[model samples]
Target: MFNQLISFLDKGKIRKIARSHRAERYVKKFSTYNHVVVMLFTVFEGYHSIREIVLGLLANAHKLQHLGINYVVKRSTLSEANERRISTVFEEIYQDVYNRHQRAFSGQPFKQ
Candidate 1:
């Protein structure tokens, strides 16, 4: 499921944005889209916490493998990751993504 979602994440663009992080200690291996960034997006979009995200992932873990997000970080892992890193970076990334999505759909209309 989310593995297919991972395929939709532009790896190079993510890596490029990731490079601006000044804190190397918080830097993670970017092999998947199931990270703090996505976690924040999920929360900002109304998911209450990491538990919800984990549950969603668990319900579709098998599908994630096919999408290439094979790393199965639990709720605890996600919470810890989000906590350790500063929130501003995650905010900026999510904001950029949100803006892009808005732009992409700016002139969209109903097809039905």
Candidate 2:
């Protein structure tokens, strides 16, 4: 969801996604790695694909900004970004979330 992205991007470096001089495409710096970052996040969060994410946005299309992306990202683009970018960093971020949860609950476990 684009609304969720507002918070997610705010708390993450995706706010700094890079674009090439030759193209309007927003290429996350690690290339294929970036694809994996998005793919994994979507999957882990229970989304099936970029299409699902895009469909979510389309449902709330009136609220989305002028992204110039009128359609779902092609599977090829998804595959290419996954193949070309550095996704391990994203996996680490996901792992860190689990680690933080562990720490929060293991020692001074919340009273609730």
Candidate 3:
């Protein structure tokens, strides 16, 4: 189920955007994919703060690989990425994913 959810994302496109933004400039350990997965996981789980995100990820660290996440991210790293990376990168990914999948929904179409 987790893999299926992530499968919707075009990783190549995401990576291209990340490169264009130079989002990995100061980061050494975590990749852009890691950051996106962490953020998406937090949103899907309704985490309210970074502390909760860290704790939740730590608790599930063992199972993250199943979701294509191999590293246990540090709070500082996640915080830094969140602060430094242009948010438009993720927003673009979201828009791209939504545009690609919107036709599957039966309700009123989403427009962004």
Q: Judged by TM-score relative to the true structure, which candidate is superior, 1 or 2?
A: 1
Candidate 1 residues 80-111, lDDT tens each?
66666566655655555556555454576423
Off by over 4 Å in 2: 1-6, 15-41, 49-71, 92-112
Total clashes, candidate 2?
10
Q: Specify the poorest-scoring 10-residue window by lDDT in model 3.
A: 103-112
Q: Show pairs that collide, candidate 2.
A: 30-85, 30-86, 31-85, 32-81, 32-82, 32-84, 32-85, 33-85, 33-86, 33-87
Q: TM-score, each model?
A: 0.59, 0.38, 0.88
List candidate 1 segments past 4 Å from native.
1-8, 23-32, 36-46, 95-103, 107-112
- Candidate 2 structure quality by residue, lDDT tens digits, 1-112: 5334323322233323322212224563324223433454466457776677556545645543333233345555665665554545454544544455655435664331
Q: Tell me which of candidates 1 and 3 scores higher on TM-score.
A: 3
Looking at model 1, how many pairs of residues clash? 4
Best by lDDT: 3
Candidate 3 lDDT score at position 95: 84
